[model samples]
Target: MCQRCEEPERPEEERYLIEVLDQIRENGWCVQGVLGTGSRPSWAYTAGLTAQGLPELVVTGLLPHHAARLLNAAAEQTLHTGPPVPGEQWLLPRLPKLEIVQLSAPAAHLHIAVCCYGAGIEARQLVYADSAGRFPWSPQYNSGRGGQPVLGVRHA
Candidate 1:
């Protein structure tokens, strides 16, 4: 969503945070979500990528702990049935020095505002398991969506 479309509607604090994130990204900083330390790691899937090639990490309708482990190698998290679970992580590996920002709106349980840092391994953040099928990637979504390049579709 564009800043104008999603920003003004946000609460004051949230609006401010979005603005800051905009600035940070503008300054060439990369921001993405990460799993929290000490908390139990949750199940996640990397469904696909945006038209821009950003990976869509889905994290819902997921199998339980054991089931998830058995299927951990899969990228598509949910079956095409069931209620949609909304959670996701937008990875920006193109830009290094990654970090996570927990907006007032909860992001699949991972959070922000602390500036916590350490360890060399990248943190595993998450997003909606259902969102794996969202626009820019899913062919069904590419139809008539006029924002980003609909990868497989040709312009008239």
Candidate 2:
């Protein structure tokens, strides 16, 4: 029998961890998405950047593919230019200016990152603006139910 057959099967979590590590090794980061409940908006986050001494990223109220694209772009930028600090505004080509806010409760929101990198993992939420260029914090901005949820307190 092959040496591979000698050992017992690994648990799902272990297998998942291996896969995530593989992705990180290949791509510098891995994106994970969480489906929303009726009361929560869908969200996605990067999981591997923190290992590179970069803050992981999160975005809410977008479809999985959209969120992944945004995160991937941001991750690429961050890798080349270093991570953005909380309260900084980042402008990506063809996208509205994004506000970077440090997550107050990363452990509560970034379950996947916490599982992979533990509770100490740092994360920043990329807060997108509306079509009218109004951010969620703006009193005049219109956000329907389950719209973008800011995972942290807005910086002054």
Candidate 3:
């Protein structure tokens, strides 16, 4: 059986997409907006800063074997062996291509949206560093620096 997390509040089929996804976002990156037409593989993407200081949607979404595969793919792509200094930005010369797989009934359907924006970052830039100083992104720094409403625009 799955390592269920308290069985959740809603029924097994409720999706709870917003609740779960929002919780994931709390781990890192501010959710600017969610995209999709209520379709099976909709995306809750966040990318570059919009004119309103909100994260822009560049692209992108979880569990069971299908979800595990997706998460693993994303993790593999974003894996790093170093940390970034302040003001240091990484240029993504190429964006990795992802293959979207569709899962069916009772198979644990989940969507894990992972995107790398800014023309200079991988998907992992959205998270803070680990205790060993891995990722190097500080949620506080991210919010304090590029966060806050800047009259709806990025300031140099």
Candidate 4:
């Protein structure tokens, strides 16, 4: 019998897991979005990249669709160029430069990745700059409160 059948109590959870697995089987990765609360910024992350030996990608502050596009593009690039190291900058065509930072608290932010890959899963945050090209750590960067949540520490 299938695992889902074995654990009939968690029908919803099983269904969701099946969906994630199916997406990963068809696409290279599965993107999950978390809507932000009043004090938090919205974020999106990839769930299956770790299976490909690449750290999952996370991007915060953008709309769900935009974040998914960025994660998908980054996943594709990693398939060709290998995973990016923390502190490295990535330039995708027609998008702002993104700085990769290893997530300091993956368990806290990446619930889906943790659920899929367990506690030891790794992820990198794709930090984007404001319109003026100033990063979040910049003193003059323009953003509303909780506009862009940096999931990792900035490496100088």
| TM-score of model 2 (CA atoms) | 0.89
Model 3 spans with C-alpha error above 4 angstroms: 1-5, 8-15, 18-22, 30-44, 47-53, 60-91, 96-156
- Candidate 4 off by > 4 Å: 1-10, 143-146
Backbone clashes, each candidate: 9, 0, 7, 0
Clashing residue pairs in candidate 1 are 59-129, 60-129, 87-127, 87-128, 88-126, 88-127, 88-128, 89-127, 102-112
Error of 1 at 144 (Å): 48
TM-score against truth, every candidate: 0.20, 0.89, 0.22, 0.89
lDDT by residue (tens digit), candidate 4, 8-87:
68777767787788889899789999998877789999999888998988999899989988888989998899988888
* Model 1 misplaced regions, further than 4 Å: 1-13, 24-29, 33-38, 41-53, 56-156
Q: How well does candidate 4 score on lDDT at residue 3? A: 55
Question: Clashing pairs in model 3?
Answer: 51-152, 52-152, 61-112, 61-113, 62-110, 62-111, 62-112
Better of 1 and 3 by lDDT: 1
Name the candidate that leads on lDDT.
Answer: 2
* Winner by TM-score between candidate 3 and candidate 1: 3
On the 0 to 100 scale, the lDDT of residue 23 in model 3 is 50
lDDT string for model 2 (19-135, tens) is 788788899889999999987889999999988999999999988998998999999999999987888899998776799999998888887778778999899999988887788
Name the lDDT of candidate 2.
0.86
lDDT of each: 0.30, 0.86, 0.29, 0.85
Ranking, lDDT, top scorer first? 2, 4, 1, 3
Residues 1-156 of candidate 3 have per-residue lDDT tens digits of: 332465555565444444444554554323333333444332233322222232222222211333233333333333342322223333332322222111111111112232222332222222212233332123453333322111111111
